[model samples]
Target: MAMESTPNIVGVDLFCGAGGLTHGLVRGGINVKAGVDLDPSCRYPFEENNEAVFLERDVNDLSPEALAPYLEQGDFSLLAGCAPCQPFSSYSQSGRSKKRGMDWQLVSNFGRLVQGLQPDLVTMENVSQLAGHKVFEDFLGYLKGYTVRWSVVECIKVGIPQSRRRLVLLASKLGAQGLELEYDPAVPARTVRDEIENLPPIAAGEQHSQDPLHIACSLSEMNLKRIKASKPGGTWRDWDPELVAPCHRKESGSTYPSVYGRMEWDVPAPTITTQCFGYGNGRFGHPVQDRAISLREAAMLQTFPQSYKFAPDDETIRFNRLGRLIGNAVPVRLGEVIGKTLVNHVRMTQGEIAVPSPAHHGRLF
Candidate 1:
């Protein structure tokens, strides 16, 4: 049988940070037209690495009319809205009040665009914890006429070298069915060693001569001792009692053992958080190196290409800002999974690919 030409599915990314999802979508064969984000820092990386324009506008200010120009260019349209997941993350829910403020409403803003535009396809990625919230149910209400499927996807299952998990949603207005991300169990899982072992070694507080982003943050004299005693995949319990922080001596701090820990080289890394560059944050310490992982290492673990540029050489590399961008991004490998699913879904609807049994359609795995 003659294979039909692949459809031209153009996409616009909402809350696109550093073009992670956009880059992955492009790799999966989707033509991303533009990436929209409020951060001006995202512009350089978004445009430099991918064939997309960067729109530095708040998603709250975006209207269907604003996206019309881009949507008109493709045979099928995709609106990807990966709202900031902090408000719905487990870290926020642990002890804080659940306030429905500006951050929480960003998901609603995404729904508004979907309601107004009624695009051919829509996708959303967020912390898996969001699936239990009322806000998530309300977001589903916006997809009344479309076939929807959502599930918590393990990043490692899709070739990401991190222990991160995210909720992924795919909805289609076309008659296609059985939408789910494809994963290959036969494929070997990537590891921290695979991602960063080859990079030139540098001491704590030293920057790699060739790669600016490969610089590690400086450690205090005490932290240097603590890290020196740390073992791969081990917790603070391995530390000498004198090196233990006063906070960890408290009863409540006993519950937080993963902090001030080191990663294991043979396995995937912990979920990269906004403070992943700090040794005291999660299990972010390098398996062998006495310092925390570098910004480049964090980005690479998020499955971003090693060559991905975060900023211009002339600008100073701010650790906090770059960490936030890299941490909050959807793993590029997962985005590629989404893009491939969307492209295959479109082909099924167009009769270019065989549609799966209806019994498997519309499942919420």
Candidate 2:
């Protein structure tokens, strides 16, 4: 790929994990100046992949002075924030909530940043369930001064290869702005095969020689046996009593059917869990391929480009850590949709550039 870039709407990403959103923004012809996150582990790939500089600092401590160096006085500045949401996940419904230190206050933490930086634009992405939470309400109220438009939208509607749905919010200080996303079934929704089928086959727990991101983390021996026994889209119900865990005999195991299941090749994979690398973890087993989807395939489904550079060694490839980055990303296509929307709005209101909305593509439908 060539390194062509344009000089418009330079923005900064808050809590940017591996530059997924920033990459999309750049693809839409915007220059991203910096990405800020507390995890230093993010530096390698975030810096390597995107045009932005990587800042290994907590967004909570970010002030106007800290963010000033990354900003230009005249160019349009955008503040984008996506806070960690482990506490609000469906898994948190159990006693998992107490053990998981999901800080409900990050929404307000983001609110503080937007207030301090006072960027011309603001945006965020999170799980759909956040739409009903009180924390999201407070986050919304704080952005009242801006023209706000938020909705619980599906990622597939924006051409992402996955079926994941998330709550997307776009707020601007300029004027009323909203996106009308377009999707066509005739275009063919992407499946695991569409993205990964052409690649050379590798065994479980192996990495490709040509592409490091084409790696798969190892599965334990017990898990290996369990995964072999499991069928694509089928649960452990097919396994013998000896193969079934004793906990399954107990009532607490019935609800855990998604585990140790395989993905249907024709269908969109069930939301890629952090454990998607492990065939026994979720519906991550490659339908006919025998091994689980490789890291590159997983990231591709998350809407990261095929050329994404991941963290350096297997030790850095911890499932939970990398999973949080992939699973919680704002699908790059969605981000592009946003960038296009903002560019159109800024052009229409401020005389920047004239662009067509999806309504103009009505003939395609």
Candidate 3:
């Protein structure tokens, strides 16, 4: 674990929204040098928290030659990209052709960059469903030169307090490294109450004066009544038939019960989505509170540290902007797991640590 003996891994995160992966990588022993994203708003949090350069340019605009400076600085370089995954999400899957035209191509672009730059290590995280697409297959083909490990990991299993699943991959040029993520069997899964229940109480539609991000969206008069009657883990079905939305009276809406439901305090929450701050969006209502989860709660559910600042003190907390950033982020804890896996692979490959026997070698194929 001594720093001097291990090969230096300088990471450059691509499509690095809000520097979530970069923060976790740094914690897991990788030196993240810079993060590149098209959103200019990401610059503050990326640079301020991680102390790394934030490039406000599209990944498509940058070429391998431009990234070589970061690659050249260390004995090893890591490039991680979690392309915008909406195109591959279940929400987009109903009755649509799986042959997506452009979004999947971003994964190809990531592959092209890796092919050209040949970073010593590479990683990617995305929706678990992406694995079935040809784009993912092609991306994997591009990495045939490296030892690659991939898995669909339950974020909760890795200590993220949400029932999120992500496709994680780790690749190394080093042979037989077999970079498998080892989940701790004994660690208890985190829950909603564990991560957010203790934050200073804020009334429905009220912002905590001291913490701007800890504000709730105002509820509609009917929605306020709905949430008040909602029980933890209960759906709108629990409400009196008269209180049910007219839409739910139709057969099509009967299947969509999770909307406007309260999250159970004891369980990991439903995946924190872009509209998670709204009272009627998914099952985001607070367990005992009368409001939907706040921006701060959403961020914390994604496992961003409590003190992690997404905006300057004077900036007004815009819910949609902050929600998109938090929802799109790779959970920091999951990134740490990938970082640690790569570090272990490097150490084992370089003989700094003994490789596991063939019987014990864990591979994520």
Candidate 4:
């Protein structure tokens, strides 16, 4: 199964932000030859960590012909794309500014490329709400010739220590031999403490001098008092009346209680959004520390290893940029499961492994 000469499987990750999926795919024994993203900030981390070529081109501009040089002819060639999904996210569905109308077409573009390439294996991840859209339906219809499996997967159910949810799809032209994706974990869901309890402590407004990424965002004195009043697993409703934001007093804002809460140690952290590094953004407060979880902590919750580097040493850590990269990442664990499932399916198709053996790894068709 060694890939040094004749690769077992080679993949190209489209919209591979910071290479989280590529990292997990490599861990699961696939050779990811390249990653494609428009964000130049992702180039360093994507290439540095995954050792994969990073294409700084828009997906809309590139066709399969353009991407062919980066992929290798292997036992299996995989195309993995997770298009920017904000337009189809549940949050977007709830508001007037729902469809940006720009990024949504990327989903169709993903389908177009897949139709063009017709790789042996295909996988995609996106916010669960995507399933409800015409773009997703059209994409699925486009893959009708292939064997496909898809489901809304709760991150916690798959042992990711966060409460995020996403839709995962796996498709193969190999018929029954194509991997069937599974979203369930054999083990119990991991919690906040399970993931980050071991990191050295830092205060509300302090950065760890030893570990730069372990630095927490600073809080205002007023916000500090508000966090102090926050209880783990409790919403802003538990805060003293004086500490409550004036917005919370508004009738419309009363429904938004999950914001400005702390994560309970024994449970999975709330979804790490692009704003998670801000204390008032979500339930992103550290359980005991009077601060928002550090950038490193947020990455960990997204299933990036603590040591994963997001920027060059000389580059300043801009909160907004780094936070978006970390939050928008596909959980590495989920990607690992997808990769392992692909490997197992190929092994089974090759008759190198049996049903029971593959089942030990994850659900198999």
Q: For each candidate, give its TM-score against the true structure.
A: 0.92, 0.85, 0.92, 0.91
| Model 1, residue 275: C-alpha shift (Å) | 0.5
> What is the clash count of model 4?
0
What TM-score does prediction 4 earn? Answer: 0.91
Locate the minimum summed-lDDT window of 10 residues in model 1: 90-99
- Candidate achieving the largest lDDT: 1
lDDT of each: 0.85, 0.70, 0.84, 0.81
lDDT value for candidate 1? 0.85
- In model 1, residue pairs whose N, Cα or C atoms come closer than 3 Å (at least 3 residues apart or on different chains), thus clashing, are none
Question: What C-alpha lDDT, on a 0 to 100 scale, does residue 303 get in candidate 1?
Answer: 88
Taking the tens digit of each residue's C-alpha lDDT, what string does model 2 give over 91-209? 23221222335667556778877777778778787788888778888888778678877877766656666778877788878786333333454566677666666777877888788
For candidate 2, list the clashing residue pairs, or say none: none
lDDT of 3 by residue, 303-347 (tens): 889888899989988887787778778889988878887888888
Q: Residue 88 lDDT in model 1?
A: 47
Off by over 4 Å in 2: 1-7, 89-102, 177-186, 220-222, 313-321, 351-365
Clashes of each: 0, 0, 0, 0
Candidate order by lDDT, decreasing, is 1, 3, 4, 2
Between candidates 1 and 4, name the one with more favorable TM-score. 1
